[model samples]
Target: MSETHVPARRVVVIGGGISGLAAAHRLVDGGAQVTLLEASGRLGGKLYAGQIAGVAVDLGAESMLARRPEAVNLARAVGLADRLCLPAASAAGLYTRGALRPMPTGHVMGVPGDVAPLAACGVLSDAGLTRIGRDAELPRDELGEDVGIGTYVAARLGREVVDRLVEPLLGGVYAGDAYQISMRAAVPQLYEAARAERSLTEGVRAIQRRAAAGPAAGGPVFMGIDGGVGGLPLAVADAVRAGGGDIRTHAPVRRLARTGSGWSVVTEDGTALTADAVVVALPAPAAASLLAADAPGAAAELGTVEYASMALVTMAFRRAEVAGLPNSRGFLVPSVDGLTIKAATFSSHKWGWVAQGDPELFVLRTSVGRYGDEADLERDDPELVARSLADLHTTVGLTARPVATRVERWDGGLPQYPVGHLDRVARVREQVAGLPGLRVCGAVYDGVGIPACVATAHTAADELLGLLATVPAA
Candidate 1:
């Protein structure tokens, strides 16, 4: 193993999303030659921000919860700590039964922890409230593995809670259908608490007590950059470049094949790059296509993980024009409401600086999540926009039309963590371990939030770096 006879190993990372960027940055910091390839021209995959009427408008995730430290830590690592802005203190609403009602306080994922709020909110009928109040005394299940959120909530708190409250709140956060999402995967803490205390209500109270004793449980309020969340990704890209890592846009990876000693990554442009190790930090489908032959079982399993399409329709209007809308953060519509829009965020109200003029231009970010409904996704952009506006007007009494509108369609934006998702992820992990010099990291495995992606990338980077250190130098 003489120095002249040994060859330096290069690591190539596919995808330029936050996960890929984080992995590449970590590898470069560990003295490895790294090249990041992104199919799209832009760096951030889902994080997009732009200016409208002299105000920054975010089309992707508006902000990340500070309680989740991964995104916050990554931002600080990339010199973005000074740019963080917390959302204003305000309540959110729920659109149910053709009316916008205030969300009951002391709720964890729309599950009532305190009975007083649920009793007074009027979002639930007297019968529904009585049924929910009985959950504290309901018979407990001792041996439940992974159950659907709908089944778990409905069984314990009655069907009304699941349909009108829990479904919409969780669906809005995950962009998923409640009937399919796993209680274990989506809200493990809630499940754990239920198992421990044998009552959902009591479990929440215990967790709240623990949180109050500690340094605030929900972390910092949802925080975004002054410019927008896009700034965070841009900052990460800059840091990667500054650390001597190459990031190539418009470089779509076609396939990954293991070679005699390392690997060969073929690009869509018919170019191939050789690397000692490769990290596939992409959406599950994209990653599956690349690893189909090299890791068939893993690829097949990855393909089983489905994704949902969505569109964000951002409309800006004068404050007086929509005066009837409550001064809340936003509102979510239950599926029972049969609304085209799943939820809408009062962007200007959430943050103080988002408004532009004397009339206080308000930005409403409306989301349309299409899980199994291809017809919903097929609607024309204009038609979709019109329907969304109509829904908003009818729900919140808007007097004027939007002065400016922007629509962003994500064909496969959200990954759905169906029941047994944890088991599937475990199988994928096992398969990946059998393949040497290959790693997979993204939202598909664990969570679908900014923090989860960062955590996955960091963990993958650590594994890859350890493998690199053990390889004989060429």
Candidate 2:
């Protein structure tokens, strides 16, 4: 990505989400002129925090994986370290067989390293438990480099484990079918171990041992901000401005093309901005559209990528109205259970800040829709809210209706990592590499976690910096 000798390098980041914000900030910090463009009126994409019944709450993602330093480190770098907070209770449960069962530990993506808990908890039937015991004795034969997580786990363990345990856990993350999700892309540690170890349990045990040896291994798995995870992008944008970068919302980039010694970005409003380098931090579809003419091969591959959409319905109720709420954080439902709602979180019970201002208002959230379940989200807000309350009533036995409800629909929110997704992404990058001073970074590429996205932003910025290294000063 090296550039020819030039003076006063300018950069245009075509997105205002967290990743775009990170890129713009990095360019500014490098003394490069930067301009950030966002299509919507708001800055944060899925990291939105708003109010419900006068109590502040997050309508999108509320927490982030703390073990990954990309997100937390960036938060601290943007002067938001003081606002960091951890979840009150990290314990979770699985709502299946019409009851809540404790989530078994010592597993990576619900692939239990120890099966004793599964036997005692009755998460799997007696016959299902018997199948698990046969894992160690299975044939030590050929397992491909990239295989479906559910298919491989079921072959080693059993179908019951994949359906009952692994399915729900993976579903909560990608909202895609487990049998089609890539093991290499989704869970690399487990995939790496499976290559050498004959037994899946043994492989998981080895991975856990390596993780526990890390510096921050024993701490809570996830964390949140004082207000919400949304504060992250807001703070980063402020830092970008402070460092002399321009951020424009409602300015969508429509196309990208190479200039004499730089790149040009065309916005929806017919605004043309040329820069020494450009970093595309957008979803696969949108990115593909802009790059169709410049990098058609990459665009074609990006067009093949699939996405899953879901809705988060936040509801607040009077504490007295919903009596006897449990101390647990949340519960997840398996798709096999034939339920409308996939998961629900007791927000007030999970976050201390949300519970601080309103002692009487108990806030909670319900998630609906998955890879193949978009019908539920199409329903009106009242219908979706009703279905969510019904699921709560059926499982937790809650009778009170919500005093305040907010519905946030994220269409095509999570990018699906189907089998061979990583290879496809590699090809996309390879195709784009032929074009100088142009790079793509977003949740669609490396990972969907906040940390992964930020790290990708850094990588893209470094690529741009690599180009700037060759430019000559006037």
Candidate 3:
């Protein structure tokens, strides 16, 4: 039998975030020469970790949903399965109306399956409850176009659900204004459920029925690595390097030009690298800036994708300081409550392994979103940290001041999938498809999660490899 010869193809991947790293790893595994360029000195874009009181704390994404298989599969492939850890389930509180109260039971992201807990829990008034109950009889919109999550929820579930429950819960995830986020992009399943069942409650019931028949329904709600969420990025980087990819930090790509044969990528150091293919896995704004001249229409559509800034403040406290705190994960702050912090995650309670069973050490991570209020995000780190601690004290009766604090600011970290995001993204995709040997993959296009980014990168890599295979041998 004759041997099939495959020519080597050089590929350049811009950005060193999870998406970019995943793309580089996938390309390298597919027998391509990969060079990953990161603007910063580190590989992980938003995934950062620092030591606090001798404990490693993740300042970026705290955990991953086990039901999302992409991240877990990537980790397992990279030999990081042993590092995985599950958090202990605990009650989550909600800071609303100048007090902290327990979140209603059977409430999935503020869309309640059962209204009894919300009514009995007093998260909303009798009038608010009545308004929510009216959603069952609310007419469904047959237009089927994408709508703002807040608008849809408010119109159907009432203002209380949007302002108190949805805003705090979903807002924390995207660091976006609920009224501005796309209902289809942010929570497509919710929209699907609504479409299938007519009522939000009934839709949730259907999902519950499906989940009950699945394996994850009885498992832990969230999972993380023993070291921290940072481990995921590190594992990805290791996989990329092991697969013969060149990962370079502090190497910012200045511009990308279409060469006769392929693409020429010029870096900040004034060096040009010609590659058979290029994968741009940066934020939409950065990607647009790099691709404007070559792919003008795509760049324009990419520019329409908006992003919001955020900061994560991790405070470490002594266990004795927060004596009466419940053994629960964390609490969210409703916008109606006029709270400065968006949400607080009990790092110690959520992931017991992260704390190494140190009863005296309690780690709390509070998030500040820059959606409607960039001013709040502009506050000094110390002031923001102080405010978060005070709110924690008021909400959970934690009197202990943090013994150590770490603050991480992510400027334009989360991309907001607005009402027309899907259309714009579709247009961007069409524009990119017009150019050969070029691809753009990232959270801005599909989803803004570790799993989604990895999956998108894998798909992009597969497409690029298929393109390489079609090329004649030199």
Model 3 pairs in collision: none
Best by TM-score: 2
- lDDT per residue for candidate 2 within 406-446, as digits (tens), equals 99999999999988999999999998888888888989987
Model 2 CA deviation exceeding 4 Å by range: 1-7, 472-474
Error of 3 at 471 (Å): 1.6
Q: How many backbone clashes does candidate 1 have?
A: 3
lDDT of each: 0.81, 0.87, 0.82
User: Quick one: best lDDT, which candidate?
Assistant: 2
How high is the lDDT of residue 374 in model 3? 70
Output the worst ten-in-a-row residue range by lDDT, candidate 3: 1-10
**Clashing pairs in model 2, backbone N/Cα/C closer than 3 A:** 5-472, 6-472
Cα error, candidate 3, residue 129 (Å): 1.4
Q: Give the number of colliding residue pairs in candidate 2.
A: 2
Per-residue error for 174 in candidate 3, Å, reads 0.5
- lDDT by residue (1-474, candidate 1, tens digit) is 011111255889999988899888777777778899999999888888876655688888878877778898889889988878787646888888778888888777777777788777678888888887887788876737888877877878888888888888877767788878998899888778888987888887877787778775656757787778877888898988997888999999887898868889989999998988899999998888888888888889999988888898888887777777778889988877898888889888787657643247777788887577546667888888898888888888766788888888988888999999999988888888777778989888889889899888888877877887788532
> Superposing every Cα of model 3 onto the true structure, what RMSD results?
2.6
